[model samples]
Target: MAVAVAVAALTLVPLAYVLVSVVAVGPAEAARLLWRPRVGELLRNTVGLTVAGCVASAVIGTGAAWLVERTTLPGRRLWTMLMAAPLAVPAFVNSYGWVSVTSAVEGFAGAVLITTLSYFPLVYLPVAAVLRGMDPAFEDMSRALGNGPWRTFFRVVLPQLRPAVLGGTMLVGLHLLAEFGALQSLRFPTFTTAIYDQFESTFNGPAATMLAGVLVLSCLLLLVAELRFVGRARVARVGAGVARAAVPHPLGSALPVTVLGMAALAVLALGVPLGSLAYWLVVGSSTAFPLGMLAAATATSIGLGAAGAVATCVLAVPVAWLSLRRPGLVSRVLERSTYIAGSLPGVVVALSLVTLSIAYLPTVYQTTALLVAAYAVLFMPRAMVSLRSALAQVPPEFDDTARVLGARPAGVLWRVTLPLVVRGLGAGAALVFLAVVTELTATLLLAPIGTTTLATEFWSNTYGLAYGAAAPYALLMIVISAPAAYLLTRESRRTVPGR
Candidate 1:
């Protein structure tokens, strides 16, 4: 209980910063700053991007999942892996690639496009898993009742997809709300970019914190909508008969068309960025490939990514355990509070840490420990979700039985529960590692003096119009994150007909 309470308190640091900053100036001043025209403009851009990205991601992700999981598309595993490859390419990199090819991608359209490409995987992975695991009995019944393919999909499959889709969309919205590098690179100002701008300016005080507070409110609205929209789903089959794979809908007449569509998606999602990188590597005459610098950056990125993953997962376990094992209002609130960090941009979290560290823990300022703690606080929800899912599958009965058989709590955790959820722990770590390596804004601010990761190097080089020089680091970031992306794919593919 103490541990969980401590974790929640730590996670609320950003919120605390906002609250403290607001109170310092009094409520009327806070209200005036928030009501400014600039604030209104930022809200429009942020909300527009969020809605557009969510819609596009929904369409693309669900369509791709249906094609790979339900249709008779050859190379199902290969297609799934290819579609997920975009997740390895951060949205900022995608913008870099697109802008390098043509200078036209520099506005709202660009932000939506890049974010959808980068985030559709969030929607794809979950919906795919649900579909893969779906007893197919429901779908089969609809088809047997004389409904056509389109009707069956709309009436039967889509309703069942609602909960998973809502959860995935919620995640995508949260990430989009906190996005910085992509929108900043695209020259599209949203609340997140404005928040960063305020912080970077000479008088970054109440205004930046105010923007963060509004962003946090936006996140809370999303959370409430998700709870209401995805309320109380009973997503389990009740039958003695075993579940099996739904018969693949034969793409008899549309085989060539399906292949072409898949090819188009693959080209747009994976090939374009990769081809651009290859161009810079081989053909760009001005490209300055700094081999030694790239290597050092790669090493630093891996170290930080690995450390963040492990640390985030370790911090997340107690939170997940309380939410799952203890299961009460306190645990639930703590879990939700940790999730608030998800809605905060890295800059907000970093600035909050800066304020707290300078005033309190000055000794640890700008240290590796401080940076890692920031990573844990910012990305803990990813680990928490994975761990919670894993824990949910471990029936409480198993723990009870182990305890009754002369085992203590620690022994049961070490012997039974931990072993069962070990894969989940690994998955959680992989998720955080992938996120940390591609992370830009927070890393830029909180990293110790002279510390440079692949992301920072890429951003710096690209920002200076050294696109060719940035190519190597960008490519390497994608390469390093590919294995983690594949792990996520395999994890999502666990739609065993019978769990």
Candidate 2:
């Protein structure tokens, strides 16, 4: 209970600080700011880009997942790897890569393109997992009834895919709402960039807080809508039976077209960014690889990532256990509260913490503790989802058996549950670590003075048009993130029996 309280307090402090500071400005002042033309314009752009990006990602991601998992596409294994690989490229890096290739890629179109490319993998990964696990009986039955392939897919398969598709779409929407790097790079005005500008240029805490308040409100509305759209359906299977494998749909005459389209998307999304990185590395001078800065940034990134991952997993455990095991309104609300914080832009979370620290916790202001708190808030949901899935796999009968054998609840958990879910916990930690390592907006606002992580170092060099200097940091980030990505992929594969 003390551990849970401490975790909640740490998570809530930054949030409370932001809300209290923003509301302190009075309703009238906040209302007046909301009525401004600039605010309206920013709101419009933010909403527009979010909608556009989410729609594009859903279409592309779902299509890719379907093709690779269900269709007779050439190089299915290679395609699956390529589809998920974009996650390794940071949105900012992809933005810069696109802009480097063509001047035209620097506005609304570019914002949508970069964000879609960077985020589609979120949708693809989960949807593909679901497709792999789905019982193909429904589709087979539809086909046996003389329905065409398209009709069978839409009527039989699409309905069952709702949970995975909606889950992926929610992730994409939340990400788009909080997106900063790609939108900023594309010269698009969004609440995140505006809040960031206020902090960087004028150091106006009140203004930034006000913007964050609005962003949070928007996220709340989206969350409610997502819950409704996703429904309360469970995707897990019931009973014991051997589920037959899905028969791959034959491409027939459309094979050439299908292969060509997939190849083009792979080239645009994966090939382009990787090629750009390689190009910069080759053309850039040898001096760009500064051993000292690289070493420092690498050490800082690993330490912060490890700390944040462990902290987030610890914080998430109580909430996940409560929601999954306890199961009630309070637990549900607590679980949802973390998602709200997670969905808000990273800058908002950072700025809120900054304001709170200055006003109330002055000593901890700008400290590594505050920075880690920010990471925990932003990435806790990643830990929760992985942990929840892992916990579900451990049967309640195991605990019952242990209790019958003279073990207490704590002993049962420690002796049995903990060992069973350690891999899941590790998977969750890996996700949080990867997210923290690549995080930019929150780190920019909250990192300790004179402490530069690889993300910050890369952003600093890239913003100054020193691509050469940025290359090494970007490469290091990619290297650090690669192992986590592999772990996630491996765990995902293991989720499918006999994979």
On TM-score, the candidate that comes out on top is 1
Runs with alpha carbons beyond 4 Å of true place in candidate 2: 1-9, 142-148, 285-287, 355-363, 388-427, 496-499
lDDT by residue for model 2 over 1-499, one digit each (tens)? Answer: 3455456666665567668877789889878767789988988888898888888998899999899888899887787777877777788888878876786988788888888999888777766766776788877889899999899888978876775666567767777777877778788888888988887899887877787777778777876776678655444454467567788888899999999999898888878777877888889663277799899999999999999999899888877766666667766667666766776778777866777778788999989999999999888767866666566545566667899999986788779777777777887898788889889988987888899999999888888888777888888888888788776665544443211
Local error of candidate 1 at 1, Å? 3.4
Candidate number with greatest lDDT: 1
For model 2, give the 10-residue run with minimal summed lDDT.
490-499
Output the worst ten-in-a-row residue range by lDDT, candidate 1: 231-240
Give the Cα error of residue 208 in candidate 1, in Å.
1.1
* Residue 490 shift from truth in candidate 2, angstroms: 2.4
**Residue 90 miss distance in model 2 (angstroms):** 0.5
